[model samples]
Target: MTKFNTTAGKPPIVVSDEDYGRLTKLATAALDRFPDVAEELQIEMERAQVLSTATIPEGVVQMGSTVEYHSDVEQRRRITLVYPGEADIAEGRVSILTPIGAALIGLSAGQSIRWVSRDGREHVLTVLKVEQPVASATPTVV
Candidate 1:
């Protein structure tokens, strides 16, 4: 598999210590489960810094401005793309463990990636934008 290259001239991203810790833990566990795969992911995740959407706070979204990548049969979808806390499929949020999620985790807007499907067709997508959760969007009783 071709490793995605990090872009140049990007600003440093900011992620909370807690979120960084969580990502580290998750990456560690993944490394144990899939040594080679985990090794690759570890390199990406460690180098990644989180940057949330305008609406969301840095601590809450564990996301960065960079794009991540993954490829697997449909069966591996759920495990790879969604966030650890956002595994509720009904909500339409995917774990970073999912292929698409993996492909998007560290990318910023305008970045693109290429991956192959089971049918041997190449697929590519660019980060049009990132919409992190915003604190103001949270409803609170007055």
Candidate 2:
């Protein structure tokens, strides 16, 4: 099996501590049902540079961030990284448990990574843009 590579010299990835904690639990629970994906998620978490949610860079691909990426075969795609429950392919929402989603987490704009899909095909994805979710303002009671 030709596994994904995070070999030396690749660009570093930054993940928020909140995301890390939640994703860790998700991966652990998926170990029995989705071993390959769980393993990949674990590997990503192992190499991630974890930061606090407030400290994470705006351009980094975090959960719920909308990202525009260029793939070697698929060309350009705009996808929102979301948890499994919120994933909807028709709406361009990708699940964190999927191959592409697992590969995209923590990556920053302008970084490119090569990952193999479930069908054993390798694809190179380059992040073109990252749109972080806007923080909701606190409601004030008059």
Candidate 3:
């Protein structure tokens, strides 16, 4: 089992070992171009329960997962979480480097996160569903 550093007083988050490594490098690389979002992602990772994908709990969000979330500032939306290179707002493919993307990473269905948007507006977002892409490398969570 994995553990979260609750001493940080934040909600628990999970991350696959593979995602952790890649996202860490991604965060570092995005520092110059996306400092705020990158820093937010770094903080989420610091409190994450790092594990292998097979052991990732059912409903947990990960790379390539399609997430259904509700926000205090906007209507409910569904989006596929993807790497920055794959992001297309028109296609509902969101980048994990964006504020909402960084906020959604590692969250499970029913989990809610409070974060600030790029425009400096604070928002609360809740994950209503998580669908791992059928073509993903990791086994799908039930």
Candidate 4:
């Protein structure tokens, strides 16, 4: 809680049409509990270029994508962006509802974004790589 930053003319973002509907619901439902982030996510979606899953080009950051990026606060991070239900920071899974996760959405390799942390510090991150989840990344059981 109490995370996220204000960006400068946020770069355009994209979302799978399939995910948009569910994400809309998520943002609306979270309004009561996590207003700031939920609202941030909602605002992102408002401008997102939603396309069919099949039309979504590779390397675009989508749900379940394992992205490698460098941020000002950290040297670099490689994590999978997941739905809130599946987020387990310990396992390198980040929820879409979190600040960083929300920022990572729709970004592709070589794209950078700037944001201000709660303490009024401005930070920038560049996406180095994006790997969409494969069937192997999902295992029904151990």
Candidate 5:
């Protein structure tokens, strides 16, 4: 069994202003269609670890993650967990609001998460490795 860090007393995750706005709208709309789901989302938001381009954990992939998953649907997918307005299906950049994206959040290499798509299809995704993105060495002239 993998021992994931127990998230206790950790500050709630933060969302970008843009992302928060979209989430707020979605939450409001869901209040009528899926009240329980909306509430659960609220909880996730409260416990979320907010990060900007900076808060992205080192050695962890944020949006624009190109990883290989081995599951019932074994295939190489360049998955991206982006917010609305940032999602590009053409590039395989899935929105964080999507089912697969929701399951992939916070997962690291060797970790597997079971997910059911919106169509009720079940699948498991195991993160094999994350390609390190090249960081610009030049310091910004602030």
Candidate 6:
């Protein structure tokens, strides 16, 4: 089994209660098809500090948050973290079920984490910025 950095020394992570509930269901359902990734997601969920959606800090990475991160191998990249069905790598939307995605959830800007990829490659990613979704937007009717 791949061992991720989840010890006491690592930085803390916070997740919104709504996101946690959705992700937990998703992870549980994925266990039969993708046990490894599902297990990792479960571990992350278990270690996360869940809070009310309104109480979660603005900079924390959550579903639909656009994150700018620097990776050991990939340098810098900005990606929007989304659900499995919404994932489109070509469009820079990463799925929460992926290794990097699971590792990023609940982290705030400047927080760094080391995670192992499915192929057994270790990577360190530091979140540079987090852009949370706007709560309200005006609709333009054409």
* Candidate number with greatest lDDT: 6
Clashing pairs in 5: 13-48, 13-49, 13-50, 14-50
**Residue-by-residue lDDT tens digits, candidate 6, 3-113:** 664556557999989888888999999999888888888988898999999899999999989999999988899999988888999999999989999889999999999
Q: What is the lDDT of residue 129 in candidate 3?
A: 98
Ranking by lDDT: 6, 2, 3, 4, 5, 1
- For each predicted model, how many residue pairs clash, with residues at least 3 apart or on different chains? 29, 0, 0, 0, 4, 0
Name model 6 segments beyond 4 Å from true.
136-142
**Candidate 1 segments exceeding 4 Å error:** 1-18, 34-37, 49-82, 115-122, 136-142
Candidate numbers sorted by TM-score from highest down: 6, 2, 3, 4, 5, 1
Q: Model 3: runs farther than 4 Å from truth?
A: 1-9, 136-142
Q: How do the residues 1-142 of candidate 5 rate in per-residue lDDT, one tens digit apiece?
A: 1211334432223444334445556656666765544444444454556556565555454444555556767676666565545778898777655656655545566767666556667677777776544545752121
For model 1, where is the 10-residue window of minimal lDDT? 72-81
Better model by lDDT: candidate 1 vs candidate 3: 3
RMSD of each: 8.0, 4.5, 6.0, 3.8, 7.9, 4.2
Angstrom error of the Cα, residue 83, model 6: value is 0.3
Candidate 4 per-residue lDDT, tens place, 1-142, comes to 3444444477878889867877888889999987877887887788789999899889899888999999988999999988888989999999988777777888889989875454556688999999988756553220
TM-score of 2: 0.90
Query: Which model is ahead, 3 or 6, in terms of TM-score?
Result: 6
Positional deviation of 117 in candidate 5, in angstroms? 0.6
lDDT, candidates in the order shown: 0.46, 0.87, 0.84, 0.81, 0.55, 0.88
lDDT of 5: 0.55
Candidate 3, residues 4-95, lDDT tens digits: the string is 22335456899999789889889998989988888888888887899997898879999889999999977899999989988999999999
Per-model TM-score versus the true fold:
0.52, 0.90, 0.88, 0.86, 0.56, 0.91
